[model samples]
Target: MDEQPETVPEPAGGLDRRAELSEFLRTRRARLKPEDVGLPDFGRHRRVPGLRREELAQLAGVSVAYYTRLEQGNGRNVSAEVLDSIARALRLTDAEHAHLMHLAKPKQHKKKQAVRTQQVRGPLRQLLDMMDGFPAYVSGRRSDILAWNRMAAAVFGDWSELPPQDRNWARLVFLRPEYRDLYVEWDQKASDMVSYLRMDAGCHPDDPRLSALVGELSVKSEEFRQLWATHDVKEKGYGVKRIRHPLVGEMTLNFESFRLPDDSEQTLITYHAEPGSPSAEALRLLASWGADATRAGTGASSR
Candidate 1:
């Protein structure tokens, strides 16, 4: 008798990869206009929004049929060069570009790994404490408040009072009215937070904790749901964050978010105001208040 032939199974996630790629491309395309991409407009009446397929193809130096197939989810094994071209045509930021590449070529895994633990090293906590003038905190991959200094608690609100699972930036931004009102540019800051989380989601698609956070925010906050739908991606690097603290009034402070070398998933964010400025004076005032609270054994929880 002849031996039977065996068939190899398709790669995991093969069925859904095209669908995800299709949606990502469509969303990116919808955010741009022909004029924005330097294309001449003939005053044609459009049925849909954003740059047309032909316009994108021309800009990306690819054939219209090829680009159409890509957007239609029919393309396979898309080349790196082509993906880079498409990313440029879409005017993607660094983080967005990386996400595009990730969508184009997803890594294969046998099973989704369990969410990694969020733990802060002792030395890192010590370092945060040493920054006497600045508000410093360490956040895990999902922007979970793993550890924070006294000043951070004073400035960003005391997280110690909340359960460990609830010590999350997204939760504070969306659920706590006091925390929401604390940001002078509340809408921009909220959008940025969502975008940062979106980037993390793309990188760690299998993290159950991340999925739960996203789901909770979607159900609880309409704004979060809308922003998440936009598919924006961003890394929280250096920026000037204006705050309206109940104790310190309004102040503009610069912040720097640094990824810890020891743990790539952890980020250390610190904030400072300009020297001799009113914001700086406010920081000093807060520090004095924090010191007083510490002496009274009420630090990081009085609020």
Candidate 2:
């Protein structure tokens, strides 16, 4: 008989990631008003915050037992139809819907297919290059900077200063010290990143890179660790960001993200301050510094 060697077991945190999500879902749902759901308060004494379990089950087109089991993390496979119904019951926005889908779906394992660093397409790169005045960059669903215009590199700060392998925006936001100083509203920005990333997890549930990235951030960043507990999610279509600069005080910039249908995995983000405003002037000044930095960083001639 051959003797078998004992193998060490992996560490278990004993924390239920699924239960955590369920509680958060229930809590968020309970916070909504009856009127919000087009239902009557009916001059009746209500005990809970939002709609009742029956009401939610009715709206979601699921049986009370099934919904209860789901909230308790008792289900094996959560179907798409069921998810859509629950999203509707919760009155979720597009972003929230995505987050729900991510939460319900199990992550699929990624095969070792000789993964290489991803980049933006040829035409998309040209599009960003043409926009000289605006801060523009192409980012993957995981917030990897596939490419950036000169101004984008300046405004967002260049990651090329680090090792070639460590270039993720989320990683930088959580792990890098410089990022905290870069954004004036670092807390808001971090929350937004978390929310948007949470939504993306649904869209690409099978991507191992996303799960690995999440795990890395969760372990490395104390701030990220704290925020991850909230279980909040949102679709970040457009938002105003207030940025404080070490050199130039404060500036408010509007951000817009456009999804590329063909790529599905990438989006283009642009930052614009108001025209004829102090922020515009500040943007110009920053652009000059950013241009210099980009030139030096990429070893490219001044444009």
Candidate 3:
């Protein structure tokens, strides 16, 4: 019989970093096949999926025992060079590499963090307002919608109508049916949200609120549970989104995310359409009508 996988109990208000590292590496390894890595495939029935412990160890120039220890969640003594070797053997992307490093060597938190509300700086809010036709918003840690402009409200519904806690992207995507209808590629958006949250979990595993949010979503949405189990992580930089609007029909918008230098936890996201395109024209119409148009179409109240 196959040995049962080891389970680590999560500490109150936090995730176990070692457990996270083990699961992440295991999933990464499971995605690969011997043929993909130039190894012989005899076409015999294999006990486990993907590369075995010995195979990965040989590829990484490490002993089977050492690799087994690492895979079993003992990475305290692992070196950077060994990590690099393992990462190369796993064929991890840049984002996945960073996430691996974070999981292996998570920042040590001395004490529990105080629950504090994230505030949007006045200048940043003013900057969003100044963007005019572009849909812009500020997102804080855990994908919280900290602040947004009129164009953003018009394009993505009036967030001001929701309670402060309900303004989060994760909640909006998973809990609200309207958002499922809003995005033309809803699955992609859902995957992106889970990836962003996974990245956040790697960085701040001790955040109680983040843990609670994950717990709530896992219980509430089966889709969220499946995606979260994949343990994917991504750094959101820029992407094109196609959304269907109630009033103006469908429009494709290019979005860019800029992390604040002073506080890396905060990011400014702006969306724009190609000049003179139909999507651009739709954006112009939405901008002219402002948030009022969104409220009228959705029956959402103003702030």
Candidate 4:
């Protein structure tokens, strides 16, 4: 298994790890040839791991210097197309591919979920507040629910109802019995959450708060601890989740996430179905019930 460094707490010498990232990547690039990525081995002994920088540049249709700059972390304005090409040439696993992109731009700081960053500018908050009919939420790369529209909060659970610290959707899913009760496929969702968090952690191995969150969750939830050990990685953006909501029982919802053009780390997710569909109806009823329940000091009833 590949070992990633701890998310926070740098070497005592105050060296810039960001600068070292490029060097580390170059070392990873120096050792292989075409054969590693299905090019004939040609019976050669290579000094590097996967591919030579020049061979990878050729395979990825890039200049050796450009690839070298990227590996050295000196390149700027690295586009997604070039990143994708490099990903394929390196035969990066799903997690490694994402980590590569993250390493490509190590300067921008992504805050922990619930922590505000420049990504949630005032205009975006206004946009979320304006969408009152459907459930919508903004999530970061780590699937942290950065912000939620009123309906979204209601659909998941009353965010304001919980203490400020416990508002994270991912943490709630595994740690709180209330949110756990809503998932129709609880175990599946739990496993998905762990695997997804694991991948995010990999891409952000040097993020302090992310490490703390994982550590806290691991110690607090046995299931989380158990699931984290699997090392399974998945790339999921849009998916349907079945939930037996405390407000509405037995409903299926489809969600779509659109990446925010302005803030690269942000993606807004919306859930919807046809107007007359049963799921839609359930959603409407839940909204009203959750609204009413909020006033009555009773939890919303599950459909």
Candidate 5:
């Protein structure tokens, strides 16, 4: 019988840094072919897929022994120049290169330092509320829904109804079926969430809460497990989302994400529809209905 894959313990604090680095490098390497990198492919008798370590080393202008050590997860004492060379050799995207750097050279956190709760300033909260027609929300580390306006609550369901811990994109996307139905492209949404989490993990490998969240998601959602295994990383930025609102029917909205300058970890995201489009009309209708629902103490509850 085939051996079962090893499972990381649930609720553990943080990921194993070295292991994460190793797997990330391996996956990145596995996705490339020798021919893609101007290397000769000597028949199909290879024992493993993709370019071998030696081939990668040749492409990166590094010795096979040195590249092997780096691939084995010993990123210590490695310079940024070497990482740049390897990233170029791997043909990594900008986001992937940043993630690789984060994994290999994690920020040192004080073991005794307390975990501070993320809070949106009153001014920022007011800014969110002022964006009357746009659906706006502030998301902190781990995609926690920090603060949101009535429009956001209307478009994305009332986050106020959820407990603090449940106000996370990872939980809402993978654990709640309503969200799966909300996104027109559910698979893309799911993949995006996992990629965001992976990027966060690279930055905060010693974060206990993040580790617990990953562990919980891994145990509860097989889809999360598969995505997590891919070791993908993405930086949240401007994008378009096609949403199927229960009340509004179908609407395509463009979203912009801005990382707060004062606190880089907190991002302000807002959604808008093209002017005079059907989606814009739908959003206006939603805004009106949402205001009425809020006054009646019955917010837009997902079906």
Candidate 6:
């Protein structure tokens, strides 16, 4: 007698985890080639890009039909052993493997719908202002830039000048030309932002604002569309960024994303330069420039 696979509860809003899993597998498969995976080409013209289904199945020690079913989003009761095998076969990164686990078997956590508010509380704003040396900003769950310190504006440009809809960090990453020029590794930064947003969407699939944001970016940016389809997920955390500020020139800084204890859904991102480095000097200059901008009521000239 054939044993039935275990069933689990569906994610919030009945989000299509199967479809996400399928696309993720497909994208990961597409990125690999026969030689890359130590397989020999038999001198036959290939019809498709990346590794063939049978080849991947062989590597993962799964039957071709079963692998096909998984790719087709029809595989039920996929076990942790099988998922680990697939992750190893695909050579997924730690972050990528974690994302795969989430999509494949999402355990139900009490879904806390993000509080919708554009206004930052007075204390939060004051905290940001207090960090005069550090460029800091608080972003909502959907990556909306709710509030920023003056130094943040100086370092990352004046987000307040843009319309409310344009205040979103994710939107600026894709749509603003200056933003592309701001990062030394623009594609890497942009990809990470999109991945973070994808992670958020998986958690709160029913959020209409998130849907609208994703839909708008998909229509406007081909890069966003391609990356979104890849089902890559990332949590915003500590990292280093190489930035090309128009006013301060090129500098590298460490950035950390901390979830506000009071508002668990909001993130406070702060950038800091290493002490006694050229970047540190740049930060000082930026702070001075920010002070000047505040006094003048006009934005600082980056050039």
Which candidate number would show the highest lDDT if scored against the true structure?
3
> What is the per-residue lDDT of model 6 for residues 1-303, given as tens digits with 9 covering 90 to 100?
011111222223434667877888888888898888899988798887899899999999999998998898763678989989999999898778877776777666596554354456778888898999888888876787778888787778766566566677788888877778878999998899898887776666566677777888999999999888877778889989998876668989999999888776678899999999999998888777666643332232222
Candidate 3: residue 173 lDDT (0-100): 91
Using Cα atoms with residue i matched to residue i, what is each candidate's TM-score against the true structure? 0.87, 0.75, 0.92, 0.61, 0.92, 0.77
| Model 2 root mean square deviation, Cα atoms | 8.6
Task: List residue ranges in candidate 4 displaced over 4 A.
Answer: 1-96, 100-119, 288-290, 293-303
lDDT of each: 0.77, 0.69, 0.84, 0.64, 0.84, 0.77
Q: Which pairs of residues have clashing backbones in candidate 6?
A: 246-302, 247-302
Better of 2 and 6 by TM-score: 6
lDDT of 4 by residue, 262-282 (tens): 875667888885679888897
Expressed as tens digits, the lDDT of each residue in 1-303 for candidate 5 is 011111323243668988998999899889999889988887878887788999999888999999888888899878899999999999999999999899887777666454567778888888888999899998888888889888887788776666667788999999988887789999999999999999898888877888889988999999999999999999999999999876768999999999999998889999999999999998899778765534332232433
lDDT, candidate 1, at 122: 78
lDDT of 6 at 276: 92
Candidate 2, which segments miss by more than 4 Å at Cα? Answer: 1-24, 33-55, 58-61, 74-82, 102-117, 288-303
What candidate 3 gets wrong by more than 4 Å, as runs, is: 1-12, 297-303
Error of 1 at 47 (Å): 0.7
Cα deviation at 17, candidate 4, in Å, is: 10
Question: Where does model 5 exceed 4 Å of error?
Answer: 1-12, 109-112, 292-303
TM-score of 1: 0.87
Whole-model lDDT for model 5 versus the true structure? 0.84
The clash count for each model shown is 0, 1, 0, 14, 0, 2
Query: Model 4 Cα displacement at 56 (Å)?
Result: 17
